[model samples]
Target: MFRKASRLRLDGSPRRVVLACCCALFVAASVVSAQQPPAQRITTNFKDADITQIAEAVSMATGRTFIIDPRVRAQVTMLSSTPMTPDAFYEAFLSILQVHGFIAVPSGDVIKIVPDANARTMPGTDLPDRPPSAADEIVTQVIAIKNVSAAQLVPVLRPLIPQYGHLAAHPASNVLIISDRAANVNRIARIIRRIDQAGDSDVEVVTLQNASAVEVVRIINSLYQQQQAAEGGGANPLRLAADERSNSVLVSGDPEQRLRIKTLIAHLDTPLESGGDTQVRYLRYADAEKVAALLKEQVTGIAQAAAPGGGQQAAPPQQQIDRNTTIIADPETNALVITAPPKVMKSLMSIVDKLDIRRMQVLIEAIIVEVQADKTAELGVNWAAWSEDDDTRFPAGGFISPVGGSSLVNLAQLAADPEAAAEAGIGIPNGTTLGIGRIAGTGVNFAAMLRALRGDANTNVLATPSAVTMDNQEAELKVAQEVPFITGQFTNTGAGGTLNPFQTIQREEVGTILKVTPQGGSWRT
Candidate 1:
């Protein structure tokens, strides 16, 4: 039983009845106390009452101590249809404080109510097992992060916590100190366990066969620094170390990163050849001369940029050109003739691989046909036509008609108006050049469409020519025979004043010829 004779409050303040039910509960407290189960059941129906009055009543029933700070003042309204056990009632009380931006922190033997922002500074229950706290009850947890450095997780996890929540990392111990609501702390802990795994990260020792371990490490670090600066990133996670004692390099990072390091090491650690050798590198896509010039410029720039040891000046541009490198392009074979040591050759070949990519090409296919439009050549279809004589040719499958004559449809003009053409059961998209069923052309705003109407369509294929051309380039196809014609007035005579039988004549080539400048930019979609 609680001491009701003392009209003093739980915090030494005078109590006031906030509602009629408040006094009734205090009056019937003796009866309700007798009915309290092992887990004290609470039947609460709080109105717009001071939260302090509610806390005082809880202390009277449960015998647990509670200290409400002077700054804590708010009105609460809660109603429970049925009774709640001690644990449930406790959670409910904590929630009321949390709704007012306060937290219930268990300090020493008594629970202290304070602002959530100051909960971390006050004494609280330490839960290491990370059991989720009840309601919004603030708790402290020291979580030990494994596999990864705990400090690394702080920056990633800080944004997830609230402003009043506290989160810190101990680098030496690789542990995280989190002071927030119990549920939130436990949530952050689960996230840490998921990402803290040391997945496929290890150290590999690469023995140097020819190259210096220190020099290899220096090149790798230099490239990494350049990339990092370009991307504006944090410190590199990879650790590269040179072991002079064993002439080996130690790489520590993810397995994929280590594989890349090993590949670079393999290329750099090759035995130097005895002397210079010649090799022909055929250019497949890029021009040999252009590639050779680019190589000369790059190699010379590297030499001139390189500083000599002991603070000596670098070699001049002209002198750097002959630094054990000789490159020439053979126009006949479109190949590069290189003369250099094995190490230099290997480096040059790698550059060639990146530069010699096949450019986009367009395949232009064409068919030249003379579809016999007349009946005699139409492969059987004859069209009626009016003519004065009986020998006149018929174009389609119709006999002569006495009534006027049928005019052929102007296909090119009809195609220009898509709306009108659709009424005729045949129409293409507006601004379309050509379409054969589903096959269509993607114009680069330069191609023109040429279409004509034919009857029965007897097709006599004259020639089919196709050519491959580079982007934005042109190609020509011609199938013709040379014909000789008289050019100069000369009699048929021999060398000795006798007329030559073949008389001076000029030979001219005339037949089917096609030229197309394909602009293949539209295919990218």
Candidate 2:
């Protein structure tokens, strides 16, 4: 029996041993390949190629050209302009292609840009003429303008028109929606003057004393057509009208068709002048940040309404994406409005809708602590104020007193006497010290404990003296990156006993409460 056991342990069967080794090798290869990043191939000749490959190829072959097909007829319409750089030009061109159903490929020294390769060409079809101007340049300029605000617009305008910033927040509060064809330039100018005189009134009404609805409609129709021509019919006037109606009120009823007149009450940032005349316009601001923040709040509100718990987290938990997109008063001025990319906007909406309720406060506190952590002096409006817009346990613009309570005490009020608040432990403002209870026995899980540690109470809880399980392993303490504050490796000795096997433990700042694990895990608080 001993001799048989020794032979089995040695695995004397060569074929069986070879098969097992081959299986292990196969699994190892699969695991390694699975861990590798997805590959992309980019081809200059073909309409469809991998993006990653193209980026890589471009980087590799700086100035080279390779012809994909010589048989295809080259009745070319060359529209070219030298921009800041080849890369910038390519980016701008790519943006245009994304909007349009077309793609461009750079082959060696030459680029083989094409429409859908699968499309069948129609006989006697008149191809539309490409716009004369550099589309990329126009788009870049428009995006830059869209990203700024009226007040921020000062510096940019100051160089052109002095004393721009000093002109007050709202020089003209009224809005004017004009038609592109209507020769009512002077009329709109007068309305602007009146609005400018209103001087920061809550409701700076712009009175359109002249220009009938028909004329405005005609101008809008023309503007719509021009936009359609530029964008290949992606711009819809009806959609714009719908958005306007959704945001504000409808003004007119069509004489023949019974359609309502569109009211453009929203402020405009840039002065829209086409054909050397003032066209359809709105009273807008460059502050896209303010608008973006408001939109995010609205999104959050909508999410909270859908949530049964009356909090950010959805009932069925969903993944949260960091949506950095915002429509703020343009940083440069309140004269123009810009928006983050559509994806950014969509992500922001997703956050408002799908924020984890359990992690809602966690997310908020994390942002607050993270922002203030750097002690950066250039902190803008309190982000908490924006988040407060949602009907949460916390009051809007006030100190959140244990979740749900009215009477908002702004940060200014809290900072008035931080020491007293810290000492009393009740209604202590942000940055005030508060005591945290370190309870023993099986009361709260490690997750709950960590949450409390990072809570407003600001207490550190040590779990070395207590029992903790790591994946059904009877361990005194389990530490991993998933558990915040633990900044080291997790080693299991399989001893199953209370072992003091701490390799290294690093301390954090005074406010930090680092958690040191028995298996070489320590939190840098």
Candidate 3:
């Protein structure tokens, strides 16, 4: 058996060894090609080649497997301007297939060259994750709408797609379904995203008080159309509608566009004679003249402050008014006739609202008391009774006690019997503090007199005065009199420095006069 084995070993076949070596080399080359396949440059000029022949050529060049559907058969004519790599060749091959009304759909390891119509219903490969390499490569994409209506976009995007392509919107999902070439699908998706973006889209109704709404809207639309003509076109279209019955302008568009339209409306929505820049707003609580005066002064001050060196030479009479708009008051109607742009009017009205409110009032009551410190106190309305014959004097005037209230009350009462009161030398203004002088025989009277009761009741009550005023207002109450006092006296020399009576007298208030200022506000204040 050993000798037979040795003989067989020596008789081994060379063909078998050669076959093994060949297999080894082939496996090594396959592994190297799989790791890094060398790029192949495709240079083809097919004058009139069958579709199958073209497919075969593409397969050989790209080293990719391909299967042609029986329905796909056409003679194609194409030429390569220059050599192209494998990727570039694939792109060109797709274009060629598309031109011939065919498409190549990738199916598991093999690419299927099928009729374009059949490719849609073929299933699986019809849906691609992203756009393909070629512009004409058919694809389907679903784009959801966020801001705009999806069904509306179908009509817009349908024109962009080829006749063989499809565009539809699923109303329930607000999503668009588009099927076209890869490039067209991507383009449509981008358009959908841009159009569906969130914007300042709202409807504003502005009431017109003095201007005609229809005319205003017409003018605004004309201006918008002119602007569009200037810009060639605008992506965002503004819609201005007018309700004549309500006399209001309806504006609908993106926020920025709507703002521009509103500004125009604010300018146009004014009385015809008012020039769209003037307004006569009637005031309710504030004095129109006062408000106008203050605002004009403020505007003038600001203009002056803004000028170089505060102010230079004399300015035009209306220069100050023109520089910062105009504010004039109407006295007859108690209205504000404003000559300014809508922007200035808006700010002015804001201030007017705050200033034209009715302020709360304050009721202030003051009690004035004149207390005599002496134990023997008199309700002291002093009176005088001097005998004309004798120079002696006696007190004679109206009196008041603890039991009786004020006597010889006010000037109104004194005027009632002025003739009789003047006979008693009581002819003085209400401000004077009466002096009680008495003649030796004449009777005397007093305003009030009271002695101490118990030991501490030595005070007398004089007057109680009150006044009502608005918030932050001042009030004065005077139940008082003015009495004359000698300020200075001069004596002339009468025949050797004898006394000569010359006096300077000053009259000052001698009784109660109360002044009060009260401020009112909210809790924190």
lDDT of 1 at 8: 31
Clashing pairs in 1: 382-396, 382-397, 383-396, 492-499, 492-500, 493-498, 493-499, 493-500, 494-498
Mark the regions of model 2 whose C-alpha exceeds 4 Å error after superposition: 1-220, 223-255, 259-302, 308-325, 335-525
**Ranking of candidates on lDDT, top first:** 1, 3, 2
Residue lDDT tens for model 2, 53-74: 2322333333333222222222
Question: Among these predicted structures, which one has the highest lDDT?
Answer: 1
Q: TM-score per candidate, in order?
A: 0.42, 0.13, 0.34
> On residues 403-454, what C-alpha lDDT tens digit does candidate 1 reach at each position?
1111112233354675676676654332213311111133111112322233
Q: Candidate 2: deviation at residue 156, Å?
A: 56
Output the TM-score of candidate 2: 0.13
The C-alpha stretches of model 3 lying farther than 4 A from their native spots are 1-37, 124-129, 197-200, 206-525
lDDT by residue (93-206, candidate 3, tens digit) is: 888898888887676677777788776665434566777543666677777677655666777888897766788877656677777778778888777777776666789999
- Of candidate 1, the 10-residue stretch with the lowest lDDT total is 399-408
Ranking by TM-score: 1, 3, 2
Q: Is candidate 2 or candidate 3 better by TM-score?
A: 3
Q: Cα RMSDs of all predictions? A: 30.2, 47.3, 25.7
Taking the candidates one at a time, how many backbone clashes does each contain?
9, 62, 19
